[model samples]
Target: MIERLQLLVAERERVLGHFLESEQREIALACHSIARAFSRGGTLVAYGVDSAETDAAHVAVEFMHPVIVGKRALPALAPPNDVRGVLRSGDIAVSIAHGAEPAPVRAFREQARHRGALTIALTGGDRVDSDHAFAVPSEDPQVVQEVQETLYHVFWELVHVFFEHPGLLDDACITCGDVAIQARVVAVRNGNAVIEKDGLREEVAVELVAPVDVGDMLLCHAGVALERVE
Candidate 1:
């Protein structure tokens, strides 16, 4: 009995190590994509089969209510049973499947693709057909699920990094000042203004006292353009 338990622990560790080494780059790229989707007002939709159902729900709730204070809440949902008609264009569809990839999950991924949504598959199968696929590379179902929970948590954390450092993602090259940040107005659309600070640019909600135009300089705060700067 003792020998069997020792072997199980060793096997689990080996599988987790292999997964982390092999999937690191793919995981980074997926997190970047998820962050971009959220910035564009996209939602995360997760689905799973059998024991994975609870994981799907957990992922949704974590995004909707982050434990870390000051982190912005992002939208997420896990549909019970069928995921059909719930996904839309610009949304993200995450399918979590253990052992063989389930038929319904595969079909849902395909449908999401047709609707212009990003598809991510976490599975213990040969491979999942999607924009991004992470094969856990574990024969043991429990090991696969355990690694998957860690993977999704990592995803959630990394996605927030992009939000926190918008300047890094947007390649903004500007110095900050007391009270407000200086930016060049790049475009004005639908009552919001896209501003370039240094070289980086992002859309900011604005209620201009006077009309503003592209190439104007403005002061921004908390993603809102407060006033034009000389």
Candidate 2:
């Protein structure tokens, strides 16, 4: 029994460490996008099939009624049985699927995308063409679901952070208007740039811009530093 417990802890730690190391930037970007959508009066619509339905419902509830005290409740809904006409432009759609990506989930994502909603998919490594596809790298179904649960919880939390910092989403920074938002590069690794903006640190993909160095001021957009602020 002790050996089994050790093995379980070891596997979970391995997977959790890998996810944190590899997917932090992606998760941050997703949170920024979702927060922007909410700021624009959008809603979060979640759905799942079979065993994944519970997760979908749980996501909706968490968003609509935050468990944390003082966290603002945002609008969220989970479609019952069918998702037709439930999504609209400026909404954020989340599809939760275990094992393989089901056909129904794919169709729902497509429909949501066509309606101009940002789509997020949590699947078992199968491509679902979502705006943000978080593939669970683990082969074990249990581990995959556990990782996905943690992922969504992180999403929910960080999105609130973005809400707290609305300046990060302003168009002035993207258009180089009078308000020039800049962040100092604290570190760079594997093409991901970590920057400190407004006293908050975030990791953004910097491949679209020129060579960056530590302490350089960068012009950021949608969680990515598009260029160096000269």
Local distance difference test scores for all models: 0.80, 0.80
* Span of ten consecutive residues with least summed lDDT in model 1: 168-177
lDDT of 1 by residue, 140-230 (tens): 8899999899999999999999788775454332433356788887555545666765335466777753477777888887677778788
In candidate 2, the residue pairs with backbone N, CA or C atoms under 3 Å apart (3 or more residues apart, or in different chains) clash, namely: none
Best by TM-score: 2
lDDT of 1: 0.80
For model 2 the TM-score comes to 0.74
> Model 2, residue 139: what's the lDDT?
79
> RMSD in angstroms, candidate 2?
8.0
Per-candidate clashes come to 1, 0
Stretches of candidate 2 exceeding 4 Å from the true structure: 172-230
